[model samples]
Target: MTRRLLVSYLTLAALVLLCLELPLGYVYSRAERERATNAAHEEAEAIAGYASLTLAYQHPDELSAQVTACAERIGGRVLVVDPAGALLATSHPLDAADQAALADRPEIAAALRGGNGADVRTSSIGGVNWLSVAVPVRHGATLQGAVRLIVPTGAIADDVHQVWLGLALGGAGVLVAVGTVAATLARWIGRPIRELERAARTLAGGSLTTPASVTTGPPEVRVLAATFNRTAALLEHLLASQSAFAGEASHQLKTPLAALRLRLDNLEPDVPPHLRGHLDAAMTETDRLARMVESLLALARMEETALTPEPVDLDRAAKDRVHAWGALYERHGVRLLLLGAPVGRALAVPGAVEQILDNLLSNSLRVAPAGSTVTVFRRLSGISAELHVADQGPGMTAEQRRRAFDRFWRAPDAPKGGTGLGLSLVQRLTLASGGEAVLLEAPGGGLEAVIRLQTLTPRHPGGFPLPLPRRRPMAGSKAGAGVGAG
Candidate 1:
């Protein structure tokens, strides 16, 4: 915009300069030529008087001397020609071969025919241009001869050139001054807009506190900045309130959910043997409720606070998650295989990767049949990192995958004891971390969950060295008490 503004200003300046200078230059040039022509005519008339008197007596020597003296004084050339079309005398000496031709000259011919005339023509001597004037040398009733005065146009041309140079310099200086002012004005107009743009980008990056200063630039720009700052402040306040509400609601609901789960556990024992299966199902439902509440709490916590990214070794995280779920896989007779080479570090928001992996692995382990394989892989390439968990289990259909990320959505034929929030939470957490989560049809007729994130190089040599958490076996542990919800 600033460049465009400057261009517009310069274009106007150039047009104005062109309109003002072009005609003035033409007028000045013509005036200079006319002034030289008038001067040449006056000198020719003066010499013509001397020639007429001298020619009456046919005194060539005396006339030539007077003309030569006048020519030298006025910096011009003078010529005297006779009626018979012969050169009588010249102010300056001329070669005999050059002094003969005179009748064909237009100004001299006119003068010989009893007319006074003037013209601009090139001199024969050295090809320099001259303004020539001719006056008839009359002896009362008869024409004696003609006196011609030729003035070199070098001085007039120099005068016009100086005027042109001055005009050019003045125009250039005006353009430069206008350009400088245009640039300064452009900066003044663009400064506030740049600040607003920067503030917007910072807000997009999850910095809710980025300041948008509103005191500089033009009045309109200042007003715009003020409006933007107010809007951002209001938006931040509203989001903070919403996040607070979600956090408070989730936290408040967890206590009652825990109490309800405990009551279900107590009721499970008192139920009759014939009703034990139904009671166990009821206990399963209660556990699913507990898991749902926990997932909701996690979701609320994530929404409430933005996390700064850090370099995490995805390969190590995958191996650790596999190790943690190892016991459950063995109890279910499912082979948990960690495939592919170790991947480099990835930039992940706090706990985002962990939540994504935990949910995906939990879903994979829940669905994998006996003698089936649940594979966990990590890949690194060109500033990107991906984690994949694939299971040889009943995979989702196209429609199921389409709506899977919607909150609390589940397929009609989905497994029981599920809350239907895992995939949604996974997607939410991944997005929060500035990554993406995708569900794909596994190559071998199973479900594959893939997570992609930006790769980061760790500053330390050990590449974000951290302790791995201990994993308990799934069969006896309370971790896998529910079915896959995603």
Candidate 2:
């Protein structure tokens, strides 16, 4: 059993043994039978020579006596019969059972028909196997009676036995030895691989420790170990550097942000209205900077928190947004068309669905032309929900569209401009909440923005939870204005 486990090596060794031994065994078996038949023919020819002239005139009994003597010398028996099929052998007394073996045998019939013959077959008497060889005793090629020799099958059997034993014993021993060596080698190779597996898994689990050394193995394993160690150290160093930078950035930014806020507070009420608006714009920029720095600080202190996500119904959130913005849409003389709602709930951070709609609504309200159609479509199919926010306004040119969602870009033709972060912030929130926002050209003209999100159902278990929508600039836009399709 211990040896059998070495199939990795034993399989090859056994195949080699089979390849070498089978043909030799076949050839050796054939030669054994041929040699025996050749010896029988030679002995029969010698006896015929001895009695060639004398047995020609002698009675059949004397001929049988001489032929029997020749066969017995070779550990076999002999038979003689006339052309009339009358048996006349007495040298070895023939039994009634032996008559049947001689009659049906092809070798016997050949000799009777004036031809030499030989065959090896199992014996019927006592079931001992035998080979029969027949030779014609001829006088000038005239039909003389035949001498048939019956040799027991012991010679060929012995040859087969010896050869088979040698092959089996030798083949088995070689296989066993080869198997033992191969198993040892396989284990030696596997040990390092097993160690590498453990080390790799450890690194994946966020360890900065050095990997297990690739000792006593192939050159590849050694090189891989060195590379792994270097990469882990590099990542650790980079993370530490980012932590220090975030700390310095927050301190540096706070002062400028505070000064900008203080400058806004000190604005004199006596200042002209146009100058006051400029001062307000500067304060907004400062506030945006402070917000960015705060976001960076949060990223630096981030941990792998298991945020369990739950389904959110966008329909309810949209209805609420329409209620909130009903007065505004009315004042703009633009209808809010809330089209078909999707069948399933959307997957979002607690208030992400609300926030995303708010941004789309805000952008739509800002750009929508009075008396033009504005459409909001909520669709659900194939385990996902889509929120389409489209408006009939001057469509963005290709170049402008490319930069439409940049942090500070604004369309030159937009009547009511923004700090460009509105759409960008919506994109950021959508991505972090495991959703996507796509902007495309509307059918007639304007923008077709589709928000595809996983629906709240048992479909995705324990996914990320997004932050709730807030009234803040970026956070406020996820809520949509109910721009009805007029």
Candidate 3:
């Protein structure tokens, strides 16, 4: 922006200088040429007067001396011709042929015909540019001879060239001055805009304390800064209030819910046999309500917190989680397999990969049937490291998948006891880590929860040794519970 502004200022200034200086230069050049022409005519007339007197007295020597003096004074050639256009006296020597050519010249012929003549042209013999002036010598209406003076135009051109140079130098000096002022003005305008951009990024990064400077730059920018400050302050206040409310609500509700569950459990022993089912149903509802409260609080905290990403070993995290959930899957008569080649480290918020994997595995386990396999694996896809948890279970339709990330939204046929916030939490956590969570159709007809994180290059070569190769199924087991290369 600063560079653009400076260029604009320089362009305008250059155009203005051209518009004002071009015509001025042209006029000065014409005036100098006209002044030179008039001075040459005056000198020719004076020499003609002297030539008239000398010619009447028939003194050729006197005329030659006068022509030489005039030539020295004006730095030009001078010639005196008789009325018949024959050269009589000249300051510069001329051969017979040159003298004949000069006498036949148009200006000299015009002067011998009792008329003054002047012309600026290039000489055909030497190819030199000259301004020629001719004045006739008269002794009381009787023409005696003609005087012609020839001046080189190079001197007049030199003067005009100097004027153009001066104009160019003046224009260059003006541009320098304009550029200096433009640079200062550009910085004045651009600095505030840059500050506003930085402040916006900081706000987006979850810092609401810093505000744009509202006192610099133009009034428009200052107003914009002030508006940004007001908006940021309001947002900061609202988020603070929301965090306070979520914290207070969590504290206020946890104890009452716990007491209610305890009360229902106490009534279990005293309740009659037929009412026992009702008591159990009441306890189940209470537990579901507690889960909902916890889910809500977790979501609120996830939204309010900003986490920076760090490198974590993808293969290690996936294998550890699979090993931890092995017992639970075994109890359900299901196999939990960690498949696919080991992808390297990935960038994710601290502890976020674990949470994301936990939620996905928990959801998969809830719907995975007996004798089925719940597979957790990691693979490298382009620049991303993808962690996938695929379950051999009843998967959601496309529409359900699309809405799954909405807070507390659930499929119509979803299993009971779900808070419907797992996917939402997974998505939030994934995004906070500069990654993404997606629900994809598994290859073998099940829902695959995929978490994609930025791949991180290992700091040192051979940092973590590769995991062991695929292992065979344990003896007497219906399904294998082991890691394998895909």
Query: Can you give the TM-score per candidate against the true fold?
Result: 0.80, 0.61, 0.81
User: lDDT per model, in order?
Assistant: 0.78, 0.66, 0.82
In TM-score terms, which candidate is top? 3
At residue 19, what lDDT does model 1 achieve? 98
Query: Least lDDT summed over 10 consecutive residues: which range in candidate 2?
Result: 467-476
Off by over 4 Å in 2: 1-132, 136-213, 239-255, 268-270, 287-376, 391-444, 453-486
Candidates sorted on lDDT, descending:
3, 1, 2
Candidate 3 lDDT tens digits, 1-486: 788988999999999999999999999999999999999999998998888888888888999999999999899999988887788999999888987787688998888887889999998868878999999899998988789999999989999999999999999999999999999999999999999999999888777566999999999999999999899888888887887787678768888999999999888889999998899888888888887778678767776788788989888888888888899999998899888787889898888888787778778777777787778876676677778787766666776778888877877666666777778878988998898888876655567788888887633243443332233322232121111000
Off by over 4 Å in 1: 1-15, 41-62, 101-129, 132-148, 205-216, 397-403, 432-434, 457-485
Cα lDDT of candidate 1 equals 0.78
Determine which window of 10 residues in candidate 1 has minimal summed lDDT.
474-483
Query: On TM-score, who's better, 1 or 2?
Result: 1
Instruction: After superposing candidate 3 on the true structure, give the runs of residues whose Cα lies further than 4 Å from its correct spot.
Output: 1-4, 45-59, 80-86, 103-129, 132-148, 270-280, 458-486
Per-residue accuracy of model 1 over 139-203 as CA lDDT, tens digit each: 78888888888889988989999999999999999999999999999888887888989999877
Estimate the TM-score for candidate 2. 0.61
